[model samples]
Target: MLKLYDNEKIVLIIHKHWFVMARTIATFAALVFIPPVILTFLPLATEQFDIRIVEPATNFFLSLYIMVLFIFLFLLWMDYYLDMWIITTSRIIDAEQHGLFNREISEIPLQHVQDVTIEIKGFIETFLKFGRIRIQTAGEREFTINFVPHLYEAKEVIIKYAHEAQKTQLPVTSN
Candidate 1:
């Protein structure tokens, strides 16, 4: 399993479905792209193309294409691998990859969360079991961070955790 976030008291792990979606998308993309790649080589393998056009540079271009293709695949995997949404006993975190070289991690305390909303739109989303969750905070920000895919379930978990955090908090009074 992927160890996303852990602390002394609690750990928030990514749902297994998240990794399943990532792997499924990656496999589907590979299936779609591989055929064209094979077709590109098919003519050469069968000697259908004339030798004049099949210069040594053809191999170079093919290698370059393959390189680019793998690079894209690697990036896709890395994006999914790095993307993480976590809620611990104390806080909520959103970690995302800006690119191959850049990453951003944002976090807010569970005590800051005031409300949570789950939105399920479209027939397909309802059927496929994926939606979005928006969390509202007591802070200056008017909107809560949004989480997609397992919105309803995620909201439930987050709210549960936040409320648990609240139970332990001392009431505050403004002076």
Candidate 2:
């Protein structure tokens, strides 16, 4: 469960573009079929070698290959599913998962946000409406989210709440 500050509400939970996940699946699917396709030429191999040993060895190796591929596919799915950004009324929470054990989370308060920039490049990115959003903060540091779908809408939400958060900043104290 996500812990929130008092009176804070979540505005958005953003994931990588659906196309990214789709492409991952497509690539893995193609890889998964490679062993079977190669096995279709099994008779040629059997003619050169003993059928019993070669067939079982091929089955064993192919099974291992497929098992390894599925594990990799699961890892990709975990990376896709776990890497996310949470936009709240008070802050933007960037949580990126790298592999199984490594994760990094950063928070940028909307009040400190200096700018939000959007970049959409290439025909695919432009047509698919997926791109990158870079957040510039008052501290001069930047945080970037890539393969972000609906980037324009995300920018608007961040800008809108950033303006609101800026309005609520503590007033300057007189010396």
Candidate 3:
């Protein structure tokens, strides 16, 4: 949910590649089985060592481990869901979610955008049509959005809006 200017329209909204979240969920699912496996072998291991461990204690510790794991997954989901790049008719908004408490937002008027480059690094990225978009601006700071899907289409849309913004708006001048 983003607020827009009266005249400004949203040109595009980009999220990280689906595979990114998919990978996270997959890893979480795999880890959820660990407690079960450990529990299954706990009796045997304890018998072999002639060690007496309370069942209630073991269950309690495993439950705690699972709770912590769930918290980690929630944090990751927040990061993934909150992080995005918004391309509006007037500007580009980069919203970065560092963790649960911190976020940084950067805005560059399209008129000041100097270049937009797309980088697809490895086989997985290329095969999945997801990569990074580097936006170079006339100002000192650069903006990079990672794991963007439909790489070429996104680049084209950004370039198009940038060109349109440039044509309609005058460049800033220094005194």
Candidate 4:
């Protein structure tokens, strides 16, 4: 959970679509089955080797490999699942997970948002309705959220909130 300023309400919470994680899931699935399949064939290929020693050694190494693969899958899922974009009434927060330890969080006030660009590249992205959303702020910094689902809606929401924030900041004129 994230801390919010007074009167600020979360308008949207965005995460990368499930399709974005498909490749990682597929790789992990393959890792779980592929190594064992290869190991099963190893005994046939190396029939000349002594079964007494090789069996124990191979089992030990296989267990170690599976353990390492599980750790890798866990880290990969954390990287994908933890990264998020939070849009609030007052600002947009970008929370990125670089690894298990390193995380970066940045915010841009709604008033500072100059432009929102949505790009849906490739056939898969277009078909799946997920793409990249780039937010160009009034400052030098830009924030890009990739593989975001419902990008058009996100852009519209940002624009709507930005306009509202800008209007609230305007000076009142005296008659």
Report the number of the highest-TM-score candidate.
2
Looking at model 1, residue 106 earns an lDDT score of: 74
- Candidate 2 lDDT tens digits, 1-175: 4788776889999999999999989999889889878899887767979888998999999999989988999999999999999999888999999998899998888999999999999999999999999999999999999999989899999999999989998432223
lDDT of 4 by residue, 1-175 (tens): 5887777789999988999679898988888897779887998987998989888898898899989988998888899999999998888889999997899998888988898999999999989999999999888688899999998899999999999999896332223
Clash number for every model?
Answer: 1, 0, 0, 0
Error of 3 at 25 (Å): 2.3
**lDDT score, residue 13, model 1?**
48
CA error at residue 2 for candidate 4, angstroms = 1.7
Best by lDDT: 2
Question: What is the TM-score (0 to 1) of candidate 2?
Answer: 0.89
Per-residue alpha-carbon lDDT of model 1 for 74-134, expressed as tens digits?
A: 7776776677776777777777776678888777677778988877677766776666667
What shift in Å separates residue 94 of candidate 3 from its native position after superposition? 0.5
Question: Model 3 scores what on Cα lDDT?
Answer: 0.86
Worst 10-residue stretch by lDDT in candidate 1?
Answer: 1-10
Minimum summed lDDT over a 10-residue window in model 3 is located at 45-54
Q: Which wins on lDDT, candidate 1 or candidate 2?
A: 2
Off by over 4 Å in 2: 46-48, 170-175
What's the best-to-worst order under lDDT?
Answer: 2, 4, 3, 1
Residue 103 of candidate 3: its Cα lDDT?
92
How high is each candidate's TM-score? 0.68, 0.89, 0.84, 0.87
Instruction: Extract clashing residue pairs from model 2.
Output: none
